[model samples]
Target: MKAVLIEADTISSAWSQLIYEIYKNGEEHKPDYSMSTRRLHATVAINDVDNNQINSFVPFGENLIKKYKEELTEEYAEWYISLPDDDKRKFDYCYAKQLFRYGETAYNTLSENLKNLRVGSRRHVGVLWENEVHIPKFEDQPCWIAYKLELLNETDVLLYILYRSWDAYGGFPANLPAIVEGFKKVFREKKLPYRIESLIATGWDTHIYESDLQAVEKIFKIAQLCPKCGNLTPKHALISTTKGKVCTQCKCRM
Candidate 1:
């Protein structure tokens, strides 16, 4: 698998660059349990979490982010308990459910740790997957496995997340901002002085599905990297004609 690293000032740029890199260099992977995809191991670091911008290229918007944020922070134990037994078994896992009401006793990993935060607590982390429960399943498993909050300085904290598998195109846009919002809410409620300095996300099997390839290409058609200079040229700077597209930066024909 190809391993790629991206550092950006905002989430939009990081996600855009990630898609471009995967489109350029990702290898085709066919897993028996899921759909075939163009996959890469991606690690993205966003320097400014507060400046996370939603990309207009994708269909995702603010409403989706808000919904995901609520799902991440809110507890749904009562709803789950009200469901029928068969339905409960069918709906095996939810990220919020696992993080807040995990196991039979409904242990709240995130709130419990935040409630007990000390002056120098730097290892506050949340678990979303239990090995004993999810190891046997090949499908319907959680992509987001865990997250950690580490103190970077006296007034800044870094949010680091890990995913066993991720859908770069569909999931990356909304999921990231929602998680950040959820964390921020808790930190504020706890009266913590630390602000989230940055966010680092690692996706072991980061991929774009085969079905979304054309859509991804369409979104980036107006803007593409120059073949010679390898710099992403703006749409207005590119010269498109009946013959082919030309890069104004390096004058490379595509």
Candidate 2:
């Protein structure tokens, strides 16, 4: 069967209820559930995100965590550290997939020379970090990695990218402009000619958040809906969009 979309009309309605159960009920006072690690457990039904399925279970998982250790790679066992109570549920699913192929095929592609890289025999790991975004444009339901990296100079850099799945139902808008710029800077500073060779867009849930469903539709109205047909137009697909348009698909001048 072909992929279908999740129909989330009133998506944000559950947020308030979710917060109440975790805070007011003192879930910490309750006994443990099976293999469950989150401080809060509330099952939510989200319709039409993955497929045209009428209903699907959505769990609440969000947290703020800090990893202070020094290691470019981490064992799965390293998850025992403490995090903000809210983040546990979110991390569990985002991390627990068994069968996975990913956009980060470059996982080990960081030059081996860079690993033990040093300025005059001192060790350095080029790194960066960022969390707790203001305005949080993606509705915050989307999944991705956030982190800070320390340079050879002991200076920390901030990085926020939709690393794993760039095409989830909603993805970050503000994060991209900064990342493209950062991509240019890092390679230039390192004096490397390599470009971001492989940027794989996985899944199709990538979208910016809006307060209500109509606001979400309004974006489609501006981006994809053709004024002539009121139908989602092919001229609006990713490549057709540009700084100034001559549509890539139809070659129609904007």
Leading candidate by lDDT = 1
For residues 1-254, write the lDDT of model 1, one tens digit per residue: 99999887778778778889998899999989778999899999998877736765655668887788787775444465556777835475777677777766788777776665554566688878888788997677888999887776677878889999999998998888878877788778778776878999999999999999988888677776543433345577767655555556345433
The TM-score of candidate 2 is: 0.29
For candidate 2, write residues 1-254 as lDDT tens digits: 11222212222222222222222332222223322111232232222111221111112112111121111122221332223548644343222111011122313222333445333442322211123332354443224343222232332222222243232112222223223334434446567543432221122222222222344344345444223212233344434344533324334534
> Which residue runs of candidate 2 sit more than 4 Å off their true CA positions?
1-143, 146-171, 203-212, 222-254
What RMSD value applies to candidate 1? 5.9
lDDT of each: 0.78, 0.28
What candidate 1 gets wrong by more than 4 Å, as runs, is: 76-84, 87-92, 115-122, 225-234, 237-254
- Model 2, C-alpha of 60: deviation from truth (Å): 27
